[model samples]
Target: MKKKTFVLVVIALVSVGFSAMGQRVDRTNFKAGIHGGVPFGDISDHSNFELGLDVGYHIALSELIDTGLTTGFMNAFINNDSVDAGPVTVEGDFPNIQYVPVAAVFRLYPTYDFKLGADVGYAVGINDGNTGGGYLRPIIGVNVSGNTELNISYVKVSDDYDFSMAALGILFLF
Candidate 1:
């Protein structure tokens, strides 16, 4: 069921993306891109890094203002090699987690092929092989081109889990 929902969401997004690009191909100057980067931070008291990839699409609403969507997936893993692993580390389950974030972005100054933006959204995570709780994230980023960007963000998770992360990445546009 969840897999089906995820697939449907991807398909719908792709359809909308194609139609949107077709509509903007002549007068709107639309730009769609993807990015990949490493996530640096601690989640749920586990000090592990995450690897992630994201996609975004933008249409010039004006010379300096544009609205778009950003979607991403990340995998986080924690290593427990010590005999005295933390209390949170238990048997029969591991600490590998996955997160998917979908957001709406408002961008400024994308014409120089470099841009800065703010993002507001929620992230859904799967933990220990089960769907976990959600989070709220506030993000800021710089796009050096349609294909490259760097971002920093703060994510707030339930029950006092929180952290900040920085990502350096490249995006491809078509």
Candidate 2:
């Protein structure tokens, strides 16, 4: 009975020690950002620039790696003249195309100021008759200030039609 009690206590102590070691009070726990850029490929024919905003919470998985959940809103301004249906045609400027992206983000920090990351998940469309699709964004970032980071990324969305964009953004960590 005493031997069993000692083993249980030892296991508890080791678990507590490891948990304590994982605690760091100096790291930023949350981040938010805004970005703008131009769309390419087939989307460019209908839209011009794209704008977006994102927020996330991150946990350090290791000294050089972090993983998190992120979500954002992005919109592309439409510039088409008219649309044709089976027998009817509508002639007017339309609403902007919007997407809400929810993704898992993995970041690899090679240095205190430089990082590379990828976001993979799905983007939901916010327009009528538009279906959502899977998305992939690969990014490179540089910490320009203590709490501010600048990043450039390529975003791709795979739906009935594929679209892509190149974006530059700034993130504020807290």
Q: Which candidate has the highest TM-score of all? A: 2
Instruction: Give lDDT: candidate 2, residue 6.
Output: 40
For candidate 2, list the clashing residue pairs, or say none.
Answer: none
lDDT tens per residue, model 2, 72-130: 89998887776554498888867777889877777899998999998877788887656
Query: What's the lDDT for residue 140 in model 2?
Result: 98
C-alpha lDDT values of all predictions: 0.53, 0.79
Q: Give all candidate RMSDs, comma-separated.
A: 6.4, 11.6
Summarize candidate 1's per-residue lDDT along 74-107 as a digit string, tens digits: 6655555432345664554455666776655566
Task: Write down the lDDT that model 1 would get.
Answer: 0.53
**How high is each candidate's TM-score?**
0.60, 0.79
Off by over 4 Å in 2: 1-28, 83-90
